[model samples]
Target: MKVVIQRVKEGKVKVNGETVGKIEKGIVVLVGFEKGDIPSFLEKMADKIVNLRIFEDSEGKMNLSLKDIKGELLLVPNFTLAADCKKGRRPSFQSSENPEIAKNMFDKFVEICRKQIPVETGIFGAEMEVYILNDGPVTFILDSRELFQGGLS
Candidate 1:
């Protein structure tokens, strides 16, 4: 699993010109599932993201977490995040999980996150137009492989 997290003032996703999900004063997460991703990683990543201290505090330091601010979350499924582009001109998606399995994983991740904070999500497997008003343009990339103690299980 990999996620690109962006702190944003507001975010929304549209599919075929119809807004599907929207949020305000939160972060936008673009998540991808890889071939060997497991269920355990989803809970760990969800905890890390909501409690991450990316928001600013009274001292102008990045000391406040999304949970502290009572912010929302926009989760977007993006299999392209798993693309292997090291070799050829075209990116290879051989490492991405099968769509059927990935969709289940994605749903599980979202369910886990929703228990912690207000959550919204883009339709899985849909072509979405995401609009984000990024706060401070702050962003981070998290990969489950690097985060886990023994790597992916």
Candidate 2:
């Protein structure tokens, strides 16, 4: 599993010109699942995300977690994040999980995330437009392989 986490003052997702998910004062999480990705990794990733000290404290230091700020979360499925683009002009989808499996994993990820904060989500396998008001322009990428082995360094 991989996630691109962005701190945002607000975010929303639209499908077929209709708003499907929206959030205020939170993070916009673009999530992807690869072959062999599991629910345990999703759980760990959620814990890491909500607890990450990416938000700034009163002293202007990045010392507060999402839990500390009582923030919301907007999760979106993005299979392209797992695309293999090393050799060819066209990206390869071999690393991406099958749609059915990926959707299931995505749902599990959302479920884990909702336990910690208010959660919003984009529809799986849908063509969506995402709008974000990024806070501090702060962003981070997380991979389960790296995070679970030791630290998210």
* TM-scores of the candidates in the order shown: 0.97, 0.96
Query: Tens digit of lDDT per residue, candidate 2, span 8-31?
Result: 999999999999999999899999
lDDT for each of the candidates?
0.96, 0.92
Q: Write the residue-wise lDDT of candidate 1 on 1-153 in tens digits.
A: 999999999999999999999999999999999999989899989999999999999999999999999999999999999999999799999999999999999999999999999999999999999999999999999999899867432
Off by over 4 Å in 2: 150-153
Count the clashes in each prediction.
0, 0
RMSD of each: 1.8, 1.4
Off by over 4 Å in 1: 151-153
